[model samples]
Target chain A: QTVSPKPSRLGLCAACHGETGVAVMPGAPNLAGQRLDYLRAALKHYRDGSRDVPVMRAAIGPLSDAELDAVARWYSVQIPAAAKL
Target chain B: QTVSPKPSRLGLCAACHGETGVAVMPGAPNLAGQRLDYLRAALKHYRDGSRDVPVMRAAIGPLSDAELDAVARWYSVQIPAAAKL
Candidate 1:
């Protein structure tokens, strides 16, 4: 049997979150090189309503555990932003 | 004469976008290493209604040019994410 690449749970996130995860929209935060723990916790907050953005809450609430893990892992390993302008 | 440190136009972005521009929230893209032009255009789109998100439109529409420039400049210079996890 062949293995297929896991689909990104990012959904419409690419509209603002670029293919590499850099934010494409204003007010959207960068996600390239953030710490893993922080990323995970923030997602949990969104899902649990600790953070209250309608878009984020709806988007995060439906994600499965595996999808959440994939998002965290993908970002944790992303290329850090270049230090130079 | 004195100059004040330019405040980040990122506003509440710090809640999800870390101080360094790395994303602290899942599904949010990394903004640390993105191209300058892409960043600026996206903001414009948000403001011009090309991108239709209540959070983004509201945020981008209220910003002044200087504030927009500051945000672009800040992300343009953010440290890229590290290669290793």
Candidate 2:
């Protein structure tokens, strides 16, 4: 679990959400230190189109459940962006 | 800004998301210390039905813009559940 996420995983999300869980793109929410179950559920919903954000749906569409879980966990364990303030 | 939320505001969210932002309901996500902007966006979405969770939509249905912001801000400043763990 300590292993870094695969480049493919971070590569796609980092375009908007940043490499270390902070969101780099405007209006993108920081994923760092989010709740694991919550992130997991969100990812699943995005992938399945239940949540229906086109960018998020497309971004996670190709991923398997394991990949989603891994990415979600990675973001969940990172230090939150707000913790610095 | 430091004034506590009106009892009506907390009363609805507190049924599942606890008074201090932790979730008392099993499936409810912890809201404490979540990003302020993110929470604001989520509250708006829940109110408007774009995010489409029936329970959340109904719970926030009666709130005004100011009330939603007040509640979101209250949750955003509280300590995170994970931080306590």
Candidate 3:
């Protein structure tokens, strides 16, 4: 029996949501093309803490359900970034 | 003569992204709290047609230098999502 392939679940989240999430740190808010049901309901509201933070409830509270659906399907595929006036 | 204030730069942006910059639309990346520098550069790219998007060009093209600065600054104030894993 062998199993352990999904360890890199956006761990550090690209060091402040970049490399795909779109953010390059700073205030950090680019979740790269977010969609997939609103990034799985905001990662299930930070793993059910109701979105208050505390490192997003300790990084989504141990994540397991398929690694939080494979890191919200890899930032919901990434593409947005537009519509700013 | 009367002066109009900013005319709501966020505009349709809120239609897709949330009231702030987070995405509520499918495939739309949330911009809640991106860095000022990064957001500015990306917007410049779109305005110049280097990133490839008709809609972005249309939206960002007419913006003057000051407008650009304002929009970027707005998104630069949001907090970031935690490290996902």
- Which number leads on TM-score? 2
Model 3, A1-85: lDDT tens digits are 1222433767666667765666565655566545567668766766766544567668767778677777667765644342111
Give the alpha carbon lDDT tens digit for every residue of B1-85 in model 3.
Answer: 1222333566755566565666666655566555566678767767766555576677777778787677666655543342111
Could you tell me which 10 consecutive residues in candidate 2 chain B have the lowest summed lDDT?
Answer: B76-85
Comparing candidate 1 with candidate 2, which one achieves the higher DockQ? 2
User: Per-residue lDDT for B65 in model 2?
Assistant: 80
Q: What is candidate 3's DockQ?
A: 0.11
**DockQ scores of all models, one per candidate:** 0.15, 0.35, 0.11
Query: Which should have the higher DockQ, number 2 or number 3?
Result: 2
Candidate 2, residues A51-74: lDDT per residue as tens digits? 778999888878777777878777
Candidate 1 structure lDDT: 0.61
Tens-digit per-residue lDDT, B1-85, candidate 2: 3556454578899899888766778667777666688788887777777788999998888888877888888887776635435
Q: By the DockQ metric, which is better: model 1 or model 3?
A: 1
Question: Model 1, residue A12: what's the lDDT?
Answer: 55
Model 1, position B18, has a per-residue lDDT of: 59
Residue A26 displacement in candidate 1 (angstroms): 1.7
Q: Note the Cα lDDT for every prediction shown.
A: 0.61, 0.73, 0.60
Q: Please, what are the lDDT tens digits per residue for candidate 1 over residues A1-85? A: 2222434776555466654566777656555555677678777767776555578777767788788878766655555543232
True contacts kept of each: 0.24, 0.16, 0.24
